[model samples]
Each structure stands twice: as structure tokens, then as C-alpha cells.
Target: MEVVAVGGCWCDFVSISPKLPKKGQTILGSKFLTQHGGKAANVAVTVSHLKGKSAIIGRVGNDFWGENRIKSLNELGVNTNCLQKTSGHHTGIAMVNLSEAGENQIVGIPGANYQVSAQDIDKYKSIIEKAEVVVVTLEIPVPSAIRSLELSQRISILNAAPAPENCDPALFTLPTVFVVNETEASIFTGLPVVSFEDCKKAVKCFLEKGCKSVIITMGEKGAVFGSDATSDPIHVKCPQVACIDSTAAGDAFVGVLAYLMTYRKDIEMEQMVEAACYCASYSVTIQGSQASLPTLTTLQQYFLEKF
Candidate 1:
């Protein structure tokens, strides 16, 4: 069976600042670059780089940013047949401030991303049905994400990012794999994910909510995984690396993990987490969003040399 994955989310134009400005104060930014981003877009590009068949199902503006985003995705070998361009809206934009330590703060404006509708998902029903895995994010309209989950057959991976207030609880029950970072886990479980025990508690909460598996990514500390099929939490430590820009690190983790689960189903959970960590670790060493994703060859060389 061919392993095909689809991503449904937003596409954004990103700007980076050297350091975040304090309230009512301005600071000189060190770098300015436009990149193809948005959590779903980043994941799609990462999957393509990892040698997987990938497609994006989302909306973009009919403006230049939207055109450039589609062009970039095509250049990266991701299928953009399902990506739509809307006339009334502009492509989403994100302003990212990167501290000297590689930590980041971002504010996103959901322009065309908010245009993704359940009808759009219905139009792409065949694409969703044939995909081995469908990746979704909260960047788009919640209804669209719900529709994608409703249409998917096998595995639906939900990357619950930019945690929304008052999110529909039913959406939590649909994904086969639930991926969230520490803050998102905290939001969903109403528990602070400050320790391993807290993460375990959050994992169990998701399982009780009917998720088949859950993974909580804690930067530098690594990630923890729990599944209804397993009895204990699995912790995979991340490899140490110098951080440059952490913009796409989480996207790398989600993308690589999804690729491994779809293409290498026989691999154990530990190996999956390790590969994801490796990919994320490499991403932070570089700059930009999609540009930071390592190709399969790069990953192979990295593991051979570093591991």
C-alpha cells in the first residue's frame, strides 16, 4: 500500500526579529526573510522532504503570498491540487520574534486560513479517503478540521497547536494520534506539564477522552508518548544541538513522526520518537520554516555521523 499523507492548515508569510520588543518599546531586528510557514504547510513540506507522498488541503489568498506559497510547495514536491486560493482574503501572516537564545514569540493573523470550510473538505473527500494519514492543525477553522477527521479512514493525526479557548471537546475524540506540546497539553488537561508525572497525567487524560495515542513534546527535554495499546509512558530524549531558530522544530517533529508511522509501521514507538527528535534537533540548527527541513539523505547522513 502506498503511504500518502495530507495536511490541512494555514500558510503564512513569516518575519523574524532578533529579539522581542517589550511593551511600548521597539528593538532593531537582525534578520528579515519571507518563508512558507503555517503549521500544516510546514508539515507537508517536511513530509515531502522525508520522501513521502504528501498533499495539502487548505485555503490561501489569491494574492502574491498565496501564489508564492503554492509555488514553493510545488517546488518542494508536495501536491497542491487541493489547496485553494480565495479572492476576498489575503494569505495569513505571522510576525515572529526570535530571542538570542533561539526562543520565539509569534502572532498570527488568519486571513485566508479562516476560509477553509467543511465544504472544502467535502470537495477533497477522495484525497482524504485515500491518504494513509491526514494531518490537521488548529490554524484553520475548527469545522474544517472536524470535517477532515470525519472523512479520514485509517489514521488522523491532530497537531493541536495555538491552543484555542473553548475548543469543542468532541474534536478530541476523533484523532488516532494526538500531538501537542507542553502548553497545549496543559490547556487540554487543565494540568501544568512541568514534570514527567504531569505529562503522564495529561497523556492518560487524552486516552480517557478516546484518543488512541498521545505525544507531548517538551522542548530540549524530549517528548513523551502514551497509547491505549501500551501500559506505560514512553520517553525519548532529544539529541543536544545548538539552537538557531526554533520556528519549525515542532513542525519537523510532527511531520517526521507522521511519515514514520505511515511508511514504517513496523517500527517501534521508541524509534519513531527518536527519528522525530533527530529531525527536530536538526531543524533548529538552521533558519527559516520550510527551508529548515532536512531531506531524507540529510537525515541519513546525520544519523550515520552523529549517532
Candidate 2:
């Protein structure tokens, strides 16, 4: 298949309002919704929309959220042969609050996500070995992530979000494509990423730590990619759009990037990068995470018209 995404799944309950509340304070929310979201699942859905054969490998609690997650992934056209149902435990749950300014605060219970172990990863070895690209995130335990990284035969793209202060050193040895946001970059490099120069240093540190390429996404300020271009970081401007929920913008970008690299044979790197940048931009124009991801037709009609 073209791309395979492996990680945990979460059922997110979100409340949107003017702002979050202070400690011990309860604030009224203007709107509320529940949706299926998980880093890997969101990426898989985005990949399917991009016309890639995306597969998912992970476990879900045999609860309602778990049932919904499987149905949602299937509806999105992601291959679910590798999705397993656990007998005990609950599907991961996230409580998210959004402000009118498009800012978010989230708390994840991480139920079944935490239960994904090395053995579960081993069960999907053949699936990982057959894809052109494998995209993973930190939603699951590090051992599972490591196992996937070890078994994957294709390009491995890791989005180390909810950045852990430390990880097994073996992860540094994988042929990984590192994707992190500004805060994650700072955490990884121990330096503030206030400028493009700071981002370059962070990317350098990541590469030296064993990544094949480093892409640092900087919200509305755009993103910086470092690899072969020594003259300057390949900077991409974020498209101007009205702000909305930005919860899964980064996932959308990474998913689109992997899909394009694997399936868009005629496109150049710069073109693919631009497409990903635009995808992230479009995601911010809407609300929710997976709901915000743009379809290929939507991308062509709205975001890529000027290109």
C-alpha cells in the first residue's frame, strides 16, 4: 500500500467558548461536540482523502467509543484489517476546551492507547513492512512506537508531540523523518525557537540525534524544513485564513506530506511541501480536528487555485 499510519485512537469531547476557566472556576461553553480523533486515525483519514491506500494498526476498547472509531476509520476508507479490539479497558478519551481566539487546552485520559504494547506492534509487522511510508505519533507507548519504527521497512515519519522529556536512545538510530512543532523543538533542543535561526539550530540538533530530515511547524508563522538545503531553511508561509479550531492542523500537514511523497510521483519536493502547507492552512479555517482536514477536491478548488 502507499502509506500506513499506526498509533492510538481517542474519542474527543470538546467545548468551545470565549475562553478557558481559571483554577476552581467553571465557565459556560457556547458549543459542545464529541468526535472520533486520534493522531494516527486522523492521519489515516487525511491520507485516504488524499487518495492513498492508508491502513491503521492499533487497539481500541470494546466500548462505544471503540466501536465508533472503527466505523469512522472504515467510513473514511482506511483499511482496518489490523485494528484490534481489546477485551478490557476503555478507548482513549480527550477533554478539550477552545477559546474564541482559536486557542485550545486539552486533557487526555489515554486509556486503551496506553495499553498498546510491544506485542501488539509485533502482530502488525507484515503490514508495516509493506508500505511505502509509515507515519507514527506519540499517542501510544514508546515501546510500541519503537517496535513500529524497528519493523517499518519504508520511510518512518514520527511526530513526537506531547513531547516526552526523554525517550529510548534507540529511537535516535532509526531512519526517521522528524516532525515537531515549535514548542516540541524547544523541548528537544533546550533553546527557545523565537526565530528561523533558532529553528535551524533545533533542526540540526534533531538531525544529529539521528533524524534524516526535520520539519518544524510554527503555527500561523508557517514552517521551516531542513535537510539538503544548506543555504536557507525551506520556509513556507501559512495561508491567510480566518482562525478556527487548530487542534489537528499539524496532523493534517504531516498526513498530506506523507501521502504526497508516496503517491504523487510527478510532483517535486517543493510542490509537495507547498501542498502540505496549504493543507495545514485549510485545516485552521474549520472547527474540530479530523473534521477540519481538507479533501483533495476542496484543496484543488479553494486552496490550490492560485498555484
Candidate 3:
């Protein structure tokens, strides 16, 4: 069974500076670039970089932007058999601003993304059924995400970045892995991320809510993984590096985790966490979302040089 990724796609406009401005403060960017970035598409590209078979299922507008995104996804070796093209609505787009301190702010317009329907999931039911792992993200409409999530009984990894509150509470009931950043973890668990111990408590809250496993990513501080089903907290530290734009660290992490799980069923939770951290670190050294992800060979060389 291969890995099938389902969700939204967006063309991102990005700018970078040393610090994000406060209300009423205007700052200039040190650099700027536009790239294709939607959590699902980004992860699919990451999976391909790991030499894994990946198929993307979602919607895009009938416009030039949407056409280009499909072309790009195809170029990355991701099968686009399920990417839908619509008329009228423009492709989804995002404005991402990255600060020199590795912080980022984004505003997204969910254009054609809002149109994904349950029928689409039914169209890909066979692929979902055969996938070793099925991945989904919240960038698409919640109903669409919920529909896609419901179609798969395989290992499901949900990268709920810029997390949403309206996702079906039933999503927590699936035999799924809930991956969220610290801020997102706080939102889902309603707790502040103040210390390492607090991080464990936050994950516990999610497990109590019924998720099979929870991963709370604390940027630079590392990530914490495990749940009530596991015996101990698998704490993995990220490699220290000179920071640049951190735009796609979380996406890279999710993609790598899914890819590694395809080959290593009994992979130590710590091993998976560390590989993800390494992938995230590699992302910060470059710019753009999918563009910055390292190939398996590149990542291997990176660790040999750093360690």
C-alpha cells in the first residue's frame, strides 16, 4: 500500500524580515518569493523526496495558478489523478511573511478549496483503502477533510497546522495521529505552553479527548510524542542551526514522519521524532515550503556534516 495525501492547495506569496511589525508599525522585508504551498501538497512533495509513492487528492481553480500548481505537483512525482479543477473561483492563495527570527504570519484565502465534496472522497475510496498511511490537512473545508478522514482505516496522520476549531469532534475519535504545533496544541487542549512538563500535560489532554497519539511540536525546543497508549514521553531534540525562514518546518516534519512509518512499522517513537526534527531543521536553512524540503540523500549528508 502506498501513501495517499488528501487536502487543499495554495500558491503562497512570501516576504521575510528581521522582526514582524506590531500594530501600527510597518516593516520592510529582506527578501520575498512566491511559491506553491498547501499543507497536503507540501507533504506529498516531501513524501516523494523520500522515494515514496504519493498521490494528491483535492481541488484547484481552473485558472493559471491552479493549472500551474497541478503541473508543479506532477513535476514533483506526485500522482495528481484526484486533483479537481473548477471554474469561476480562483485558486487558493496565501500571503506568508517570515521574520528573521524564524517567525511567520500568514493570511490564506480558501478559494476552490471550499468546493471539495464528499463525492470526491468516494471517487478515491479505493486509493484510500489501499494506502499504508492516509494524510490529510485542515486547509480544505472541514467537511471535506472530515469526509476524507472517514474514508481511510489505515494509519491516518492529520497535520492540523494553523489549527481549526470546527473540525468534527469525531476526528478525535479516529485511530489517527494528531500532529500540532505548541500554539495549536494549546488551542486544542486549552493550555499554555510554558514548560517541558506543561507540554506533556497538553498532549495528555488530547489523548484524554480520544486521539490515538499526539505530537506537540515546540519549534527549536524539540517535539513531544506519545499518549496514554504509550509508556513514556518520547522527547526528541532538534538540531541547533542558524535560522532562516521557518515557513514549512511543520509540513516537512509531517511528511517525513509519514514516509518513515511506511518502512519502519515498529520504529521507535524517538527515531521518528528525531528524523522529523532533522527534516524541519533542513527546511529553515532554505526558503519556500515544498521548495526547501531536502531529498533523502541531501538529508543524510546534512546529518553527517552536522553531527
Candidate 4:
């Protein structure tokens, strides 16, 4: 049986710089590349690369970037049936600056991403109902994301990235798994997510807000997973790898986690976290967005070498 995954978010065009510029200061960049990105698109491609059936539901402009993004997704074995194109809007874009240390800063132009409405979710209600896991990101309109979450019949995984300034508390309760980085965790909980205890506190706060399970990703420190079903949290250490570009690391983590939830449901949580950690670690060793994601063969080889 083929497990189906559906994602709703933006498709972005990204540019990379060697280092971010200071106030009114200009600097030379090392490289320039274009790839298909956006949290939803990245997750959908990751699912397909991991041998699961995946589809992306979102809007892009009827321009060169939009056309290329759809074609790229199709080539990667992702179903583009729900990727719509708008005539007037431009495709979403992100200007990403990376330091030699693999740190990054991104400025996004929402463009057509913000145009994704609740009506779009309604049009794809059947897809959501049929999918084994539905992925929602904060990059798109909140209403559309909320509607998609509401429509999910099975598991719904929410990757709350670039956390909204004033997110509705009710939105946090809809996902079976709520994933966030330290910064987003801090934003949502209004507490400093600096230590493991801080992450534990943040997890408790999210659980109190109705989240069934909470995952706080602490980058090099590994990740912490807490749930209502278990009293203690599971901490999975990330693999050590030389960092190249940390652009899509989090997206890769979310993608693999969702893929496991959809297809490898019988696996232990520790195993799932290990796989996700490996995938994310591998992603940072490469540069670019979707280009950084590891395919099943690459991931398996990594495990064989590491374990």
C-alpha cells in the first residue's frame, strides 16, 4: 500500500550569500543558485524521495519560477495536481544569506503564498481526507492552514516555523505532532528556550495549550520530544557532520518525521527520531534548499556508515 502525504505552503526562489550584510554595508557573495523551496514543497519532495506518494497544495504565480517549480516537483515524483498558479500574483521568494559557520538569515516575500485561502483547502478536502498524514506550515495564510488541519482524517503534523507574532491558541491543538525550533518554541511559550529544562518547560506549555505531542528541535544539541502519552521526554542526539548550508535542515527533519508517521507507524519513537535526526544532519552537509535533502538510498548509506 502506498502511503499518501499532502502539504500546504509556499514555493520559494532563494538566493544565497556568504555572509549577511551589516546596516547599510555591502559585501560580496560566494554563490548564487535557484531551487524549488517553500516548507510545503520541500516536505512533499522529501516524502516522494523517501518512496512515499506525495502531493503539494499551494499557489504560485504563472511565471517562469512557478512553471519551473511545478515541473521540478513532477520530476521528483511529487503529484502537482493541487499546485495552482495565479495569473496576477508572483511566486513566493526568499533571500537567504549564509555565514561560513552555516548560520542563515532569510527575508521572504509572501506573494502568492499569502493568496492561499480557505476556499483552496475546501477544493482539496478529498485529498486531505485520503492522505495518511497532512503537513501544514505557517508560511501560508493561517486560515488555509487551519482549514487543512481541520480536514485531516488521520495524522496531522504541524511544523510551526517563523512562528507568527499573534498565533491563535486553538491552532496549536489541531496537530497530532507539533514541531518547532528553539526560536519558535520561545515565541510560542514566551520563555527562553536555552536549556533542556527550558525545552521541557516549553513542551509543557504547549501541551497545556492543547498540543498532543511537542517536539523542540535544539539544532546541534539534538531534539526533545514530549507527549501526553508519556511522562518523560525523549532526547535524540543529532549526528555530527560538517555544516555547509543549514537552509533546509528543519524542513528535512519535518519531512522525514511526517514520512515515518505515514508509512512506518509501527516503528518505535526513538527509531523515528533517529531517522529524522540523520536526515537533518545529512541535509546540512550540502548546500541549497531542496538540493540538500537526502534520498532513501543516500539516507540508508549514511546509516550503514554511521551505525
- Expressed as tens digits, the lDDT of each residue in 1-307 for candidate 3 is 3788888789999888888878889888788888999888888999999898998888999999999999999999999989999898989999887887778898999899878887888888888988999998888777777777788877888887667765568667664788998888887777997577888888888888888898888888889998766976677888887777688888889888888888667766667778888878878888678888767976576447656
Better of 1 and 2 by lDDT: 2
Predictions in order: lDDT: 0.81, 0.82, 0.83, 0.82
Tens digits of per-residue lDDT, candidate 2, 32-143, equal: 9998788888889999987778998888898988988998899989998888888788998989998987888889888888888889888878888988999888888988
Error of 4 at 4 (Å): 6.3
Which sections of candidate 4 miss by over 4 Å? 1-18, 302-307
What are the per-residue Cα lDDT tens digits for candidate 4 across 34-74? 66688888888888888888888888888888898889889
Candidate 1 at residue 98, lDDT? 78
Candidate 2 pairs with clashing backbones: none
The residue pairs that clash in candidate 3, if any, are 17-100
Model 2 earns a TM-score of: 0.94
TM-score of 3: 0.94
- Model 3, residue 285: C-alpha shift (Å): 1.0
TM-score of each: 0.93, 0.94, 0.94, 0.94
- Arrange candidates by lDDT, descending: 3, 2, 4, 1
How high is the lDDT of residue 192 in model 4? Answer: 97
